[model samples]
Target: MNALMAPFGGWNMPIQYAGIIAEHNWCRTKAALFDICHMGEFIFQGDFESGGLEDVFTFSVKSIPLGRSRYGFLLNEQGGIIDDLIVFRIAGDKVMIVVNAATAPKDFAVIRGRLRGGLFTDITAATGKLDLQGPLSRDVMVKLFGEAVAAIPYFKFITMNILGVEAIISRTGYTGELGYEIFIPAEKVCELWDLLLSDERVKPAGLGARDVLRLEVGYSLYGSDIDEETTPLEAGLEGFVNFDKTFVGKEALLRVKEQGVTRQKVAFEVAGRRSPRHHYDICSAEEIVGNVTSGVFSPVLGRGIGIGFVRPELSAIGTPLTINHERVSMEAVVCDLPFFKDGSVRA
Candidate 1:
């Protein structure tokens, strides 16, 4: 069990088992197994309206059909997001909430404080998550679980028996690749892990490769690209925030909408291989505008790509810019997200 370590969201986690590039390529071409056991999960069984669960998240939970999940933020009273999470509508009144690893405790406290009744349990320890991702993910699931998994649409999940145990297979994944997040009892997780790895197509990948993959596809990392200080409007994620329904932060967001946002999240590409990193200043015609929040070397693009906060006017596509750090400077240009468009995420 040789594992290299790296820092992630205040936790020292495995970067890769074999190597980053090899694991990444394996996931792209064949199949890859990822140990996502660090993520947090909760079970909430109660009336959506009466338990105050409906008013908790930025999105409506009742609207999510059974076997489906919705992604959104949980905001504090100040319109600041406490954490971003996904709610799986497992049944009529039973929902499972998946949250970030680091923010699990905070999210639990916030939700519990808001709830009046029903059973809410933090099942993080009892839950172990493994992701199987690749162009051939569907083939693997279909062969292993049956056609039910194959027919499941994107963002939908199906609870079925795997290895003689109940498990949930969700079509949603963080990596911009065809993948499934398999949630099973913690005791049985290692069994599934070994089962998936027994196939010649699957390899083990860690958080490092997953980050680069997600960022390359222009997906926002929870704490990096967005936080309590930034609203969905400013973060370019208003699509997840339903304006037609009401939530805790609706008034603040609506007020901000009326006035317009000052700083907006923008994706950019460096002119060369020199990657712009976090806190690197972004300049336009030598005038400072914003700074990079997340940046990485895109293997597919063979160049540097990043996302940053900049003046709304300067956050347009093809805007010429320069990224400057302490002793490193690089030429960059604003570009649309999903720098790599040919992902096999859903193929």
Candidate 2:
């Protein structure tokens, strides 16, 4: 139960419990329970268009079927990302928006400013979220929740009663593993956490391990890999943007697409155990091309791996690069996404 604590998104949170590497390995092989209550959740009720909700994000809100969720972005006028979020069609006239912990306040302000109608409420304080992730997560969830838990597919969700309260059990997660994110009333979350941990297959993981897991799968960290200065196109996430839809940043994005993005996000694998740290210089032939955004000594790969933004011409797979910071330098190679490819995310 002893854990290393650190400050994150204005909350004192656990950085690690048993250990970061151990927890990361456990999440890859078995179920790892993460206390993710710090994430922000918002509820919107009203007409999707009349409330100005349909035009708020890069993806189409009205097109999402009920009981399903869609991942996309909110952007500024210059097409810079405001926040990357997931929208859930919880009911006919109601939807839930889940966003990053640190960007919650700003995201709320930006979203509310754009909305001319609708009842918008921040439900983060009242909601508690826990991520149960790993290859065996499906089996563990089915045993505790019900047979229905096993039936939920990727990116889908269903409301179920747990601990005498209605909860949303979504088959979605950040780790590249078969997982579920459970949202329940704040008061009952601890009870459910305790009950889940009582099972032998589940262990506690923390933000430190979570970071490594997400990065290994090539998922961007909002503040690190992508931020207000970056657009989805530049981040290689054009698939999440629907240009046919009218959005706040559509014009700027179109312009960027026409002119071409100056820099692009790239994933690389280090040749050794030396970890690449944030802000480390990425170079080719002794010239700096970009900087590392997120890096770690990957337990699964047994080597250093990192994500960074580089000139578009330098992002090709198999390109040789050097990651340098002060006296530290290491060899790296531009590689295809998902530095770790054996995950059971879709299996």
Candidate 3:
């Protein structure tokens, strides 16, 4: 396969297998397999509360039910996001923390520093992750792994034997589709990847398609949409933050809540086929209000869709705005999240 390659988070990754739009459409209608082995995974074992893991993130770690996962962020003292990640509660004394590849080293140091007592180790090198996503993903998993695979619900996972090795198959994904993320031993990833692709319904997808799939569903991409300088509140992700819990940035977040955020994240749709790009100035009238963080020409919606940060007052629905970059400009209007809504994510 003559795949386009690109550098991402210190790894040379496939940007597209066939083409971005073709793979994106395939995921919406059928099944798309993604090699997500470049992500970072860490293991922590010990007492969640006494080990200081409970207070490390914006959410309560010990409160997460076994076999389930929670999405939130690690923040600095200033309430800025360190990284948005997911915590999978594997057992009473252990949890798996999945983070972005680029921030793995920093995230490890920060998390280890906060822990007073625990057994923590990086498992990224030993683990290989693959995501099979689309409306028909459940059927494929069930057929390949037996009926047990179908029993898992969204946000939940099960430890199962795949290719004779224990693997974690979670009903979670970046794409807005019914999907499963399988974490297998590093040695077996290629075998399993090939096995899944052997099925007629499954085709290999790449980062390009994954980005479009996630954006279409309004999911933010770390380092692009949300970053170290952006707070959850400013990113319109306050629901993931547990204000009731004690966290590193709790005080700063409270102060922000009291003072109110000046700018807010907003989703908008372009008037035509013109796609907005990152760093494009978002203007209201003649003044610049914000900048585009992520954008794509959506095959699902047949228009350009984008996300950006704008003044609080301009974040309302139906507000007209212009996305400008050099001489390129496009008309857009603030709209509801999930430009494409009929996804099979929960189905």
When summed lDDT is taken over every stretch of 10 residues in candidate 1, the lowest stretch is 5-14
Residue pairs in candidate 2 whose N, alpha carbon or C atoms collide under 3 angstroms: none
lDDT of 1: 0.88
Give the per-residue lDDT of model 1 (tens digit) for 1-347.
58798776566778988888777777777888888888999999989988889988889999999999999999877677788899999999999999998889899999999898889999998998999988888888887778998887778999999988899999988778888999999999999989888777777898878888888899888788888888988889888888787688889988889999999999999888987888899988888899899999888788999999999999889888899988888988888878888887766
**Count of backbone collisions within predicted model 3:** 0
Clashes per model (N, Cα, C within 3 A): 2, 0, 0
Give candidate 1's TM-score: 0.97
Candidate RMSDs in Å, in order, are: 1.4, 0.6, 0.7
RMSD of 1: 1.4
TM-score, one value per model: 0.97, 0.99, 0.99
> Runs in model 1 with CA error above 4 Å?
7-12
Deviation of model 1 at 224, angstroms: 1.3
Worst 10 residues of 2 by lDDT: 137-146
